[model samples]
Target: MTRAFLGLGSNLGDRMGYLKDAVAAMDDCVAVSGIYETDPVGGPDQGRYLNVVAELDTSRSARDLLELCQMLEAAAERVRDVRWGPRTLDVDVLWVDGETVDEPDLVVPHPRMFERAFVMVPLGELAPDLAEGWSDPANGDCRRLGDWDELVPPASEGIS
Candidate 1:
């Protein structure tokens, strides 16, 4: 299985639940970073977001993974009416096995991930050394939360 990195975020209803649900639906969840609350990126003024970086083991192709992400978004009632709009869930295929995928719809290594604290902060949790080197714009105030399980309890906790 390929080790893939996914950036998960939610700014709408049941933010943490939506993220956990999306994580539950995936395969081989290796590690999930602590949560971080941050301001919106490119959308209209909206609520802060609960975000994390999820490292997973998957055999699916990059394109397939993109589809899976979209499916999760739809299930979360994501609306694309606005660019970078508030969402119930936002799952971006950040990086997959250090490979570069530049499809018409998806971009691996997430083109602008380095410019956003929301992605870098939690990413630092999973991989400190690398996340430390990553430089973001420092505009958004990303606050680290307490515990990963507490903020987003595992399904085994009966948090379905």
Candidate 2:
């Protein structure tokens, strides 16, 4: 099984519920990072987002994972009406077992990971090994919410 990292965020209604539901739908291949509430990053005026990073052990290819993430977003009623607009859910593939994939539709290790604290903080919690060499010299605002175990449900909870 390849290790994959996913970035999830929600700013619309029932943000935490959307996250819980998405994880529940992923079966047993996923483990989530601590959830952090963050300020809006860009695009437009919007609500703060509850963000988390997830680690997955799966046989799915990078492209397939991207598709699956989109499906999860759709299940949460995510819409693309405006760039960086509010959404029920947003899932992004952050890394895939040290593989670097560059394609028209997907990029591994996510092109913007280092620049976003919301992504880095939770990611650092779930897989610090993967985040070892990555750093943002200017990062000063990101704070750890808590331990990953304290943030996500226990593995025995089985997603829901």
Could you say which candidate leads in lDDT?
1
| RMSD to true structure for each model, in Å | 2.1, 3.1
The reply for model 1, stretches above 4 Å from the true place, is 156-160
lDDT of 2: 0.82
Overall lDDT per candidate, in order of appearance: 0.84, 0.82
Cα displacement (Å) at residue 151, model 1: 2.2
- Candidate 2: tens digits of C-alpha lDDT, residues 1-160: 8888888899999998888788777764567877788877777999988888878888888898898899999899888999988999999989888588999889887998888888987888778886787777656355556655576665578655
Cα TM-score of candidate 1: 0.90
Model 1 lDDT tens row, 37-116: 88887768899999998888888777888888999999998988889888899999887885788868988878888888
